[model samples]
Target: MGGKQQHDIRHSDRTPAALGYSMPPEWAPHEATWLAWPHLASDWPGKLDTIRWVYTEIVRKLVPGERIHLMVRNAAEEARARQYLHRAGCPLSRVLFFHHPTNRSWTRDSGPIFVTRSQRPHPRAIVQFHFNGWAKYPNWRRDRQVPEAAARHLGMPLFEAFWNGRPFVLEGGAVDVNGSGSLLTTEECLLHPEIQVRNPGFSRRDYEAALQAHLGVRNVLWLKSGIVGDDTHGHVDDLARFVNRNTIVMVRESNPRDPNYRRLEENWELVPDLRLEDGSRPQVIALPMPAPITFDGYRLPASYANFYIGNAAVLVPTFNDPKDRLALGILGELFPDRPVVGIHAVDLVLGLGTLHCLTQQQPA
Candidate 1:
């Protein structure tokens, strides 16, 4: 085993160690959220400036209690990122920049899977898996090592998984775990034979088993697909999100005429039918989709579900649509303790992702 197993967490009948790699709950704790500054000009087209401001605004909100590790290709870009963060009024102390070159800025997919285990009698923190650009984006050499490299920088054990290491594909954005043994993912992203390109002989069982072994996910609720206009090919983060163990917030499309209408409605139908590892159905909340918006002849995939839960505030991506206030109000209700601030994502969506798409939470 690439990881040393420990048995301790008594959630109900099963221990975390017995589940799989035994990563801790999402709400367990976090030192900070990790993000890689988007430098690939190809990703943002002509809107790089607008997107930088979006990220800077995001850092400003998360800097209250949680730290932010920002990755830049080199010193030149680091200075540029620093200038943007400074101009955006982000707290300098909470944001730390590293020299890691990546093909893209979606760290939530390329970055590490931070897991925690308290049963070791000592501080045990682990990061599993790496990046291969989802078998779609070519030239992922740099993105591949981010997880372990960041882990070494953080001084934690890099528990790289064995057995399942060879040809399995899973992105952090595609799977949302409540950190309580239940996981939510989209078959459109993971099960697509064209995207993940399942090994010839391996069946769905192999994929599920791999998820269980590596991510400590016991109950995987698979929704059929994801939202349209999503370039990553139907990542779950864009459709459904785990607000907590028992509560889930999903994106719903009311317009049956839209392309995403049926897919989202299908997810709505599937949500109520699933059970967690503890054998309990979750309380589901339906968040209506903001009226669809487009920019420069492109339909930017926008979702209220892409909000990032930060230490001080819940950072929401706003499309500047009329529904912005309503989305914020809803989130404010869910997270009563923290202020839900919307960062205008009209520009960020041009890059094909929002707040949570750009950051990965590093467990404390």
Candidate 2:
């Protein structure tokens, strides 16, 4: 029956896994990085101007190694972004703008997930998972159009993620892959039936099957929870990330009295026990958490684990805390070949995310 079932599933031959395609890790070579220009005033409220400057700086740093495919609301917004990029001395030749309108600036969640296969008439394709504004916010109708827009722009074939003949809702930030066959995610994010309820009736086995069928992952490592202030409930990108195929960098809090201490500690405890598909344990590194960042009595999710790995550099978010330098130094040692650049994210976190939450890489 197992053999027959496998043959029956392979008869369709439409899934990424069926075609030998897989989502590569961030450290892999990339064709470009995708970002949505910050336009909606409601997202950052009074800090839109400052956030625009932040976006410009991020573009300046990224243009040296690879192209940046930026999205704008319209022609006017594109012209404004062009002016800012010119002033920031960005390499205009390396940046391309798309007129795709987005409800928010977080392209990491709404952007296309590019997958690649070795042999091909088509080596590049996109997995368009349904986005529902993290299951909390509204005004996401425009945001939902981003993945299809990106696929059309690249002229790549689109594969929609579905289960039981229903569209499956998933945010890219909820999971991290090692480019091999292992995936890292949080139970609090994907398995909680009531809270953020991505797929209401999906169980742990259901999620594992879906991941294996679409992302080509063989092992699913689950962390118990995330930090205290993450609005998405528990995104693995904010708690832990794979720095390399065999190494993981997880956030650790030393102060027991802090609100995030217990939860982060529990997640860290699961690290040593995790093994890859080869039955080998990965080397776990402890990255220090910055002092809590707050704005208007609200705790912002300021985390060092939210760093984005680009083709030529790793952009680490710094919160003006004392541990910022410490985290940079540690990452520098870990990634000797790539430069570790820190971006001041104190203001950026006011939107409840940092570097990794804003950009998505396109594999070269």
Give the C-alpha lDDT of model 1. Answer: 0.76
- Please give each candidate's TM-score: 0.90, 0.96
Point out where model 2 deviates above 4 Å: 1-13
- Candidate 2: worst 10 consecutive residues by lDDT? 1-10
Candidate 1 RMSD to the correct structure: 4.5
**For each candidate, how many residue pairs have backbone atoms clashing (under 3 Å)?**
0, 0
Q: For candidate 2, write residues 157-276 as lDDT tens digits.
A: 677888777777889899999999889999999998799898889989989988887888899999999888899999999989998898889999999999999998888778778998
Native-to-model Cα distance after best TM-score fit, residue 362 in candidate 1, in Å: 0.7
Model 1, 258-302: lDDT tens digits are 888988888878766889889998988887788887876777799
Off by over 4 Å in 1: 1-21, 121-124, 164-167, 196-201
